[model samples]
Target: MKLRVFNIIKNTKVEGPGNRYCIWVQGCSRHCRGCQAVHTWSHKGGELYDVEVILDDIFNQKDKIEGVTFLGGEPFEQAEALGIIAQKVKEKGLSVLCFTGGKLEELRENQINKKLLDNTDLLIDGKFIEKLTDYSRPWCGSSNQRYHFLTDRYNEEIFTKYKNKVEVNISKNGQIFMNGMGNFDEILRKVDLMGIK
Candidate 1:
């Protein structure tokens, strides 16, 4: 199968745990306002590439990367192609992560999307809300999104246990700042009082 993708980053530290290979697939419809990757929202925006070819490149980096991340253009839209890549990544014993605007409930209704979900180890889901931007949320652009650890392991749980929010800020001057959930003093206080840590 062939998939349209905007770009491929061989190594990324922010998208997921450790270092990850991030694939930005092409096409999206839920054009959220203030989307960071606005260039990726159009359906006809990216280059076409064969799934096997992309897999070959990923395999080349298997030695150094911890896992692979599937970002949009709504990865669920390319479910068929992603399922193929996810299968190979599983064979390598590498963790799999996905970012999507579609809710997990809706994804479960489609067989193809379900396959993509089955192969994913971690999922960050829901549309990005600009008004909800908090520099202290983990792996999500907005506070309304969620991170699910689909697999048996507790990696994401541990991550959230330490800090549930992941904050990121980028300035026009090209400066970047990222902090974990604990940095939000009010949230930390709630977590402590509620014994939710």
Candidate 2:
């Protein structure tokens, strides 16, 4: 299966428990208000790659990462392709963490989600609600989102072990990309005031 990918970070800590390989799949139908990733909403915008190729890349980084994380445009939109990668990764003894804007019950109703859910160690669900925005918890940006421990890999300890944070990545060409969850607007505002060169 081929997956439309918006971006990939070979390793990042703030995205989940321990270091993780994060894949931001392309396209989202939710378009929730105040979404920071409008750039990922276009279904046709990102490059396509075979699931095997993605699995290869994940394996290459397996030694350094604790697991893989699927966040998106909407990971469930490309569930089957991601499921292939997730199941393979789990077989390798690495965990899988997935984020979706839809609730768990709603997702469970879809037969295509079986493989993905079965393989995902941690699943974060629910759309971002602007008014209910709260960053106290780890990873999830809004209060409406809930975390599900589908496997024994992770549990409620995450609440005490982690907190909302962001990682700043600057590529060789000077492109700055930020990931993870928090109040980005305020963070950027503070950065602007500092005027760092």
Candidate 3:
């Protein structure tokens, strides 16, 4: 299977616990207002990569990464493709974290989405509600979103340490990127003022 990928961050500390390989898949049907990744909402453009190839890359850095994270354009939208990758990640003894705009109950009704969920170690679910934006929770965009620990790989208590935190990285080429669930616009504004890229 091939996944329509928007971008990939080889090493990151903010997407989930520890160091992670983050994959932002292409296409999201839910165009939530004030979404930080609005560029990812469209399904039209993105590169496609075979699932095995992606798995191979992740495995290569298995020693350096705790797990892989599946982010939008709504990971559940490409559930089948990500499901395959998640399963293989498990076989390699790595965990999976998926961020989605869909509710858990709604996802369970679909077989493909269920498979993706089953393979996930943790899930951050719900649409990004700008009005309810929260900065106190770890890995949640808003107060309405939730963290579902589907597997026992991660302890809930660990989240308390990450509350209200954000990670910013400057690439070798001088481009800046940030990973966090809160205050996206504020962070962007700061980045813009810095004129880093």
Candidate 4:
């Protein structure tokens, strides 16, 4: 299976409970207004990477990471490919966290989506609602989004700790990227004013 990858962050503390390798899969069907990642909304964009190769990359740095996180375009949109990768990651004893625009019940109705959910330890679900923008929940873009803990690996307290916190990274080439749950428009505007990107 090959996944259409929009971006990858090798290490990040704000993605989950600990340092994590984050994969932002390409393409999103739901183009919610005020979405920060408008660049990732196209289904035809991004490069195709084999699932095994991605797994190898994660395994190579397994010791430095507590788990892997799948963000989007919509991780569930590429359910089959991600499910395979998630399964392999779990085999290596790393936790899996997936963020999806689809609701849990909607995803559960599909066999492939169900497999992806089954492989995930935690799921942050629902479309990002601009009107419901929330700054108090970790790993969730909106108040309407819910965190579903499929396994006992993480607790509510862990989620609360990282809420409203943003992690900003500047690449070697000086491109800027931001992650975490909150209204980041103002902060990003400041970054733009500083001419960082």
After superposing candidate 2, which stretches have Cα over 4 Å from the reference?
none
The Cα RMSD of model 2 versus the native structure comes to: 1.1
lDDT of each: 0.78, 0.92, 0.86, 0.87
Model 2 clash pairs are none
Off by over 4 Å in 1: 154-197
Model 2 C-alpha lDDT per residue in residues 139-193, reported as the tens digit of each score: 9888889999998889999999998889877678867688999888787787668
How many pairs of residues collide in each model?
A: 5, 0, 0, 0
- Between prediction 2 and prediction 3, the one with superior TM-score is 2
lDDT of 1 by residue, 1-197 (tens): 88999978787666677777989898988899867667788888899999899889999999899899999778998998899899889888888989999899889988878668888988889888878875465556688888787897436454554334444455578554333323345655655587644
> Candidate 3, residues 65-174: lDDT per residue as tens digits?
99999997989888998999999898888899999898999999988787788899998889988899776777777889988989999878866766555778788987
Candidate 4 structure, TM-score to reference: 0.93
Which window of 10 residues has the lowest lDDT sum in candidate 3? 158-167
Misplaced by over 4 Å in model 4 are 192-197
Candidate 2 accuracy as lDDT: 0.92
Clash total of candidate 4 = 0
Q: What is the C-alpha RMSD of each candidate to the true structure, in Å?
A: 8.2, 1.1, 1.7, 1.5
Worst 10 residues of 2 by lDDT: 188-197
Which numbered prediction scores highest in lDDT against the true structure? 2
- Would you estimate the TM-scores of all the predictions? 0.79, 0.97, 0.92, 0.93
| Candidate 4 backbone collisions, by pair | none
